[model samples]
Target: MKKFTYENITHAKELNIYLEQGNRVLGALGYTDHSGKHTAKVAMTAGKLLKKLGYDDHTVELARIAGYMHDLGNSINRASHAQTGALMAFQFLRSWGAPLEDIAIIISAIGQHDESNGTAVDPVSAALILADKSDVRRSRVRNTVPETFDKHDRVNYAALSSTLHVDVQKRIITLEVELDEGICFLMDYFEIFLQRLLMYKRAAEVLGLRFKMKANGSKIS
Candidate 1:
């Protein structure tokens, strides 16, 4: 069995085109940037989440690999991107000579990252869930024309900065954000992200941690 590291997959060069094309597919549908920026953020955060909690190096690398490829299925269709993305990653990793055991973890993490049809299924999946959902920022809004922005776009655009921090010692994971209330109220954040927070709480629990949220300076969840 061969071992493939995150650095190897990220530097492959050939995979860059697929990630870019996947972003194009979402862009055509008026979605936020799910391209390199979003995927890279998820990959880094997922790997860090596991590493901070003392997961094995190989498992941490697997999380990063899964995070990077999670959105590729959006290239084919967004409706079932998680499921499709998992299959796509499986093929790519298998062809690249990744161990079948490692591929199993990566594909499972990719397949279950979406909130609509997925939950925290394991440590890696939970980490991916928390990491993917934590990335909310104004830069992710691809809809430049504010006049045409929807609730999702407006809320995301209102987020000036967002950070997900893990306090492993305290067994807590907190998502802190600074939002421009003039553009969108705190209520707007909850309106769109309440379900996400609930899901996040569940994910954190899987890692033996409590999930928290702070908007501006107040803890809301």
Candidate 2:
């Protein structure tokens, strides 16, 4: 049997189509960029986190795959996208002859990434949750019209830069964001992202790490 890798999943035509369509759907609804850029960022972030913690290569790769495919179900609908994406990924991975155990881990991580109905079930799932929630930046905001910008747009646009730092020695995962206060207030950001940050905290706890958040150089979590 061939070993399935992140490259295989990333280049899959059907999955790529779904990701593009999902991004389009989100764009039409005035949401942030949920396309290849976002998925790739999540994949890299999850893999890096696991790698820093000394996880085996295969486990880190599984986390990467889960992150890449987590938002594919948004192509169908926003509600319950996690569940739908998990089912879709299972079928696709099974068809690719991936091991059942690997499939289970990937799908579980995908399904548990959303803050609405998600938890840190395992290391992969926890990593996925942290990575997905940490992706906030100006580039994510697609709505260019400041006058018509919604809360999500405002918060994302206000973020001039963002970075996720994992310190293996300290067992700390920190999300540092440089916010443009002229664009949006700090309170506005917390109003929209507090729950997501809380989820990140729980996910970090699952990995025996401390999660911290800093906006404009101030620690908020």
lDDT of 2 by residue, 1-221 (tens): 15589988898898899989989998887789998989999999999999999999999999999999999899999999999999999989998899999999999999988889888999999999988888888888887789999888999998888888888889998989898999899999889988888898899999999998888898887
C-alpha RMSD in Å of predicted model 2 compared with the true structure: 1.3
The list of candidate 1 runs beyond 4 A from truth reads 1-3
Off by over 4 Å in 2: 1-3
The number of the candidate with the highest lDDT is 2
Which lDDT tens digits does candidate 1 get at residues 170-210?
99999999999989999999999887888898899989999
| TM-score on alpha carbons, each prediction | 0.95, 0.97
The C-alpha lDDT values of all candidates are 0.88, 0.90
Clashing pairs in 2: none
